[model samples]
Target: MSAGRAGAQIKSFEAWDYVVFAALFVISSGIGVFFAIKERKKVTSREFLVGGKQMNGGPVALSLTASFMSAVTVLGTPAEIYRFGAPFLLFFIPYTFVIIFTSELFLPVFYRSGITSTYEYLQLRFNKVVRFAATIIYIVQTILYTGVVIYAPALALNQVTGFDLWGSVFATGIVCTFYCTLGGLKAVVWTDAFQMVIMMIGFLTVLIQGTARAGGLRNALDQAKNGSRLEIFDFDVDPLRRHTFWTIAVGGTFTWLGIYGVNQSTIQRCISCKTEKHAKIALYLNLVGLWLILACAVFSGLIMYSYFKNCDPWTAGIISAPDQLMPYFVMEIFASMPGLPGLFVACAFSGTLSTVAASINALATVAFEDFVKSFFPNLSDRWSTWISKGLCVLFGILCTSMAVAASFMGSVVQASLSIHGMCGGPVLGLFTLGIVFPFVNWKGALGGLVTGITLSFWVTIGGFVFPAQAAKTHPLVLSTEQCVQLNMTETAPTTAPSVIVNRPALAETWYSLSYLYYSAVGCLGCLLAGLLISFITGPQKGKDVQPQLIRPVGNLFCFWSKKYKRLCWCGVQHDSETILDNLETDTAWKQGTGLDGLKDGQDHLPGYNPDEKSYTNLASEKVTHF
Candidate 1:
């Protein structure tokens, strides 16, 4: 290693890096602008938010993957394997079942309900207060989550290429914001489709080249097994243990439910389909796409394990941060093969920018329709579009600032998982209760939401406030090296303490637990509390509640009845019957089969009256759920 050779290596790495990143930035921005202009007419409120309910299955499925696989997957998954082991891969298996469940059970329900924002269902099922609370939580959590996703890739790019990290962050955010503000959901979906292809191609290329360098698949597998990075199943039942088979199977399923079934960023894509069948097909296809992407990511990690066996980057100090391992590995590969680095960088930026655009689009829609419209009744459609675009710019700035702050935080994966756990659980719970448990009243739903959220936050932030039998007897150790070693081997050393501290404070594997458990906890909490409150407050005489209040619940119950053979006991036969009964009961029966079955000047049902106007006029407007 002469001085001349060393200098050449450094110079070559820098030259290739700049070329790759520059090419990626141009490609992403170009595609983004093209879609923005193409879909500009669709940028009005409804079209801007949900694509005017006209997206097809292929684009929707692609967008779903693009939305979920952020910079975290590109930078974090490989880094995870570089530090820990392969068990992290098992967390994805349960998601297969989750996709199936969502396609069959959840997507159809949302499509049939005919609502724009999922939060709108909360309003109909419970009250305005519940809807507002859920919406606020979603907006806040999404901004934070999207911020971290955007930041991670920027950090990786900066470390490898010496680009200004904050500058990269600002550039990515502005491009995403501009496109989303201009083209709305259509722009997001089309661009995501293009981006997903690039990401997969980049990942596959790395997997193949790294495997070849490590002496082909057989040799790579042998190296990984020797290095103790191949373990895929753990049967541990301990609650504190991360990435156990049981936890991955059960907990991972719930996490997917929250993400695909509840999260607006995902569900909005599904609902945007032109037909219910299209939505269901898109969702299932997304499952296949997700598995393919995860496989590519895991294979890449294993290949890296084989190639860098004796010289781990985290331990050798070649890379100061864990998340930089993947980018560094790509850079090293590019040192040998020139233009390949550009492809990988393009893929990474594609993932990051697509997610940002989707988040900004969803957030702006929620802000205008759900939050702003209530206060400013005089706001016109054109003004609403401008306002939505303005919010996108504002949020882009806020997210970039958060990225700057996150640069100083702990491991990228840990920070992201922790933030997701804190908010995802409670929100999922509220939505679950509203759809699944018809008896849950507003007061109970609200109380349950608060309780579940508080409990989840307490556990995540403070840890076991009072260590039970497990905590007192086994204090969690916080060593990064030990944690990494423990993950590779199923059996712990007899001499070491049973309670070893987990590195990253909480293992990234537990993130699935934190996210998945929320829906069950929140739903159970709301159901119990709502039931108790309804009992205490005395059941509202069927006459007291609004007709629209019963619409969503009735549809949910009807869906369950047809799918699961459950009988509804709320004195309504079909969804239509429920709406008609409520309209007659409230004297709000103006239109005959109106938006909720009370149509104008005609009451088709025998018992329904025709003069009731108690229900709000907005109920008459046709609501496109997608």
Candidate 2:
């Protein structure tokens, strides 16, 4: 077999490769054109922002999966499993709980609130300051993460395929921005659904082919087992340990809540469904989609280990970073294939497109509704749609530029994830404090948010500057015994590793908290601090707050049980049927559908007017029990 320079086959994109790659952009852009022309002249802000609240469940669910399952998950999870081992798969455990918690607790509150932006709930629950605080956090976190998502895959693909690095970044950013800005949320959703299929097929091609190359599934598992890469459970209680059972189960669930439960992208998509049941169906379908994509990612890691069992790429100096491993493997595995390489890269870009589009769309919605609409309450609805489109264009440019700039940073994979956890925890806490614990006043919510975010940043930044509190868990052994066919030089030293003396325990230091636990620490801290401040500064009675905003977990059990209902919900009692009806009725008016709203003798909210803001609390005083 002819092994080119560096023991890898010569990789280059051919005609078919370009065709396959360009097809993704063309189809995605075509979807945008379809939505843009279909809604021309009649495009209202509601139609633009939330798909007119008439989207079907299946496509929206796929889009939701694509939104959260970024290229980072496609490229990074395998790298995570390859380097750190299989304990990372424990994330699946927490995901199940996330679906249940989000569907039951968070979804009902936001869906019923009849708000375009999720942060608007903060204003209703507490005050404007809290709402804006969470909104700003989300904006910063999502923008930064989108940059990493765009740049990381481009960087890795460039290293392997000689693909233009900056060119890839600009291409993804511009194409995604163009489609989403023109097409609105419907374009993002439909394009995401289309791109999601490509992502699945591309990754599956790699997994199946790499599995066969690693000597079939049985042999792959056998080799992985022999190499110690199959170790899944680690029960260490140390918080600093990166991938322990407790950390993943507890910390992972918290992190996911920060990502999924109250996220604006997820909310906009869910509520866009035609009915409440359709929305629930979307969430549940996304649960399966996440499981499938993530499973493919993790199992591919094992397949990588099996193939490299005798000749590790990193150990042999064939790849510079762990994230490069999968791409390099792709270039090598499909070197002769006409278009599979492009398909895989397209897979990564699909993830990037989904994320960037979601960010652009969600940011526009939040900025327009939370800030612009609030300031210009008298702004016409026609102008609302136009302004939202303009914001989409603005944010799209800003995020794409950020992606290009992110190329200057070094090793952003973990830092971006950490930053997300640091911010998401507090945002999640702000909402949790509102829905689960009604006594937390605005002052307490703001204080808790400040406290939690400050501590999270302190811990995250400290870990970078400080020394290790404990050693990382041992990695499975790697080897380069069969690199003769490849051009490689061994850089790993042959000497025995140095030993450490008097290492402090993981729990001994605050900064030693694992990145996985960042969300948990921040969330728990927010809850504790918010409650203390609420008590000190006069906590409000549950009866005084709106009954619809509070859905205590304590009352979530036994729907027919009256005692738990009365005791737990703070004298606010409503059956599931009554709650869903209220949500449906209010959602109808709030989302610009007049079917059961103004016509059904429900004057609780004003009629939907295209020339006026959808719904507003022009009343300054507390207006309870509408």
Candidate 3:
């Protein structure tokens, strides 16, 4: 009789959980649809992807938050905490500085240039080869990054609710594809704003509830400190130590500099803002939000330490994998809260979908504007928009498929970061060369980009291989799994700690050095190579180059000088200063008529007609610096 009663209770709980998950899914889907309809009219070509250059500061910042959050934050942060303690938080310090620098230094240049795609700047700075190389790197990186983001949430939801993982991934992808194809940047940004709110609520709820269950915030902190989970700084100089103060501070800054300064996803958001000032404000706001989120995530991890002190997930069989730690905690918290799990799922999906949509939209913009139009000269906005939409659908499907495949790869977080590190450096290098070193020729930029990517791959793969071999030959070196499992024991398990001392295997410290460093290295490599090649190839004459190509750089540095006194400084003969001054005064450039107004006046230069052709004609001019 007692057994029967217990079985009945279990069945009832299971049924209730199903109801909650289902209701949450339906409501979240409705929210997405509602936003899609609200932004339906703005779903035109350039506007759909770039938000028509009219997105406000708040929405842009929120969109950025959603993009950066991802399943990585929800799933990876807990897993990292479970393994490495609080030192991982140091990664964000450099990121904050990078955001400030990128906003102050890079945003104005992108805004002044008036280009939709960051790759367009490559062509202006160097040659088409650099642009093509950068675009390919971005496309590859986007697909991989988006795939992992999609996979993280799906993997978590699957373990918690027993949902079909691939099906969940496909469902999320299809929804994102439909809305992104229909609505563009506005839809993505607006939806992202809501998503960011949902994610914070979900995270905060878990933190508060877990802390309450663990006997309050003070107890949680006390327990974390006792267990050594509260250690936030590691000042060791060993390259193999993953979270050292120097590595995270110096290495992390370079990583974020590549991300904020050079990456397309980040730049696309900044460029979509209404004005340079608005973009700068959005970036600063994003920094604040990012710091808050990291703090919340770190606190959540500490709370987990208190709650799970008696029975760790890896040891108890509640979660077989480290990444499943966050989901397990979520399930335990929302077990009694009706409709909350659904909301959480929606938030997770929202983060994944917002990121996917942004990438797809950006990828489409790059493809149509950079690659397709180069070959097809007579493409219309309508046609180009359709092409981009079609590509979005195709890429969305491809990414979903990749997400399903990601399950076979061990450790989703590590794989994602590694992929980023491998490719990110080279792309960063190529862009840096174009922007900072004006004299680098196409050949040098191309060679440097290739060399940088190749070197990064060799170093990364070598690091992985050497560690694995050393671990097998000399059993003293601690493997990544062993390091992660160390905290699972009630008391720190007694093992020969000296086995890891000067062992041949790669240390956990070096694991953090993945592709995040790639961009900085690639940028340096490209600059040096480009300069060397330019020395060999010789410089182009000044008169042979177009003036508009260098206008933004000139304007930024010449702010206190009269070097760019003409509005038509780039041979358009319109006094650039006057046109820029008038736009600053009237803000007419926001309406797209600033250039059109210059068509019929003394502002117009011979053969520089806007209506005669698209901006690619400007690419023909040689780039020269005074």
Candidate 4:
């Protein structure tokens, strides 16, 4: 039911194409080597994880933009928009709100918390058990998905362009491992900045060429309009409707918040900034790059429609799967141009490099900060650095092994991917409960996390047991008039588009809800269950908890709960202090952002020297938190 190629062989790569592809690996590897030598870690592991808290806003912002963008976005977004209507483009409407929430509510807390792992906040607010559980959830989810991400795309690329399947997979995995192991976080962020440039150039090339071939932008729009693919508004109130305004916009906002609001990679990058103001500026700048890329994806979808308006390649059996459409189109159009196809391939691989590298780096940070350091608090700085490097190398190999395993799975990969996405809502719920609602205790948080994940998996598993009818989720009209097929002649377009219909039974209705709303469902479940449990078990006084852990929403709804005394909003305490804490008995390297928000007595810790600049020691010798 996916790609079913007709007869013609796909064009193979030329010499210039190989050169372009080779440069991507060389440039990427070079960045890692440069940083690894310049900022060699002789003391502790802090610099390896967060760039010594001295990274500039611009490069870090670019890295942030690249880290979240996977091959799925580069390959799948166009295919998604091409198959469905342009209403999918409305998903970005909520992405703006995602950035706002991360900057205002989440980023500040992580930036000042003095913790390396994002899950460290979970421990600080709730308990170590909660932190370990969340860390485990992240580890499992990231490893599984990362492997599938690298494998499936390599397989598809091989089928279309004669690229080496196992070779590309192993090469990508090892090269990423080499650089990340050698350079640490500085290498990851700098390489990401470089890779994103290649990615953007590739996107621009596709858009400009495709538009020119289709006559112009206006003509492309007209073609898209004729095929009923130019729609952006779908006001249908039905929950089962895919790509509706409610589902794509409202529901999507909630979905993205789970990622931008609390993902570990995102938190790590923001924490690397010199100041909170720099973090804010970098985040806002990141929106520009992200939105630009998405716009290309959506616009490129229209260009795909323009080229295949009458032919409908997938319908004509010229291509097998919707996901293969982009690869086919690239080879089909850019073959004669030589290096253009190579550039596109490099663009796709850039996505692979940035995403996997970032994941490996995060896994290393969390593994050491959450698991290793907790058990062995007395380790020397040199030993801690070695342990951290060893963890990075270990994760990189595990990820590669998982990629090898991915090649053996069939439809199970999709199911695994869906399960991977399901865990995010619960993770987001854990952070939201701790940061937004103070009355929710450790027990409430643990219970809510379990309840949310359970409900999410139940609904998702039910979906697999009884899949929806194909006709119910059909795409708009597509004609195959121009394609020269064996049996069919003329355009095949007699059938009307399928309309949304109500299911009869309760279970059927449950299964019918669109995947877009999954995050909302899980989040709401967690919040509601957590609130109920907190009230029954005697919620904590807002006054008892520190305000830095809580996001100050208003002078916030203090009157909403003080009368019942069920929940009370706390007031924030702000004092004047610039991070300059020195430890003589403890250790000190580059002073981290953790020392940023110290209070009256705590801010003025002993041996506070401002003239020292050393990377041979660590201040977190005890792994202390304020």
Ranking of models by lDDT? 2, 4, 1, 3
TM-score of 3: 0.80
lDDT per residue as tens, model 3, 1-626? 00111111111125555575565545545665676677667645456556777778998988787787766787777667756578768867887788876876666556655566788877766777778888888888778777888888887777767777788788778876775665556667777777788789888878777887778899888877877777777676654455567767876776667767777888888877877778888998988878877888888877876666555655544456777777776666656775666555555666787788777777777877788889996988688767877888888887777786667554665667656766776776776655544455677778888887876676666555544332211111112221133335653445765554453433443433433444455556656676677678874333343333333345555677665533223332224212223223233345332131122222333334345422222322322110
lDDT, candidates in the order shown: 0.65, 0.74, 0.65, 0.72
Q: How many clashes (backbone N, Cα, C below 3 Å) per candidate?
A: 18, 3, 24, 10
RMSD of 4: 6.0
How do all models score by TM-score?
0.80, 0.87, 0.80, 0.85
Any runs in candidate 3 off by more than 4 Å, and if so which?
1-44, 380-386, 463-519, 539-579, 584-588, 591-626
Worst 10 residues of 1 by lDDT: 1-10
Clashing pairs in 4: 2-320, 2-321, 3-320, 3-321, 4-319, 4-320, 114-594, 587-618, 587-619, 588-618
Best by TM-score: 2
Question: Residue 290 error for model 4, in Å?
Answer: 1.4
Q: Tell me the deviation in Å of residue 357 in model 3.
A: 2.2
Q: How many Å off is the CA of 429 in candidate 1?
A: 1.0
Compare the candidates by lDDT and give the number of the best one.
Answer: 2
Candidate scoring better on lDDT of 1 and 4? 4
lDDT, candidate 1, 230-341, per-residue tens: 7778787754554557666776665566677778888888877876678888987888888888878788887876666655555533456778778877766556687787
lDDT of 4 by residue, 1-626 (tens): 11123235656778888888778767877888888888874434567777778788899889888776656666777877788768877867877888888899898777766777789788778888989988988887678767866765675567556868888787778877765677767788888898888878988898888887778999989988887888789898887775788887767777777777888888888888877788888898888888887888889888987887777777776655566677777776675788887788778777687688778877887888889988998988778878977987899888888988765543322333354446777788888998888788888888888888887767665665556555545577776776655443533446789986554474457776666667777777888888788888888666556555676554345445543333334322322222333333233323643655444343322323333422211223333322
Comparing 2 with 3 on TM-score, the higher-scoring candidate is 2
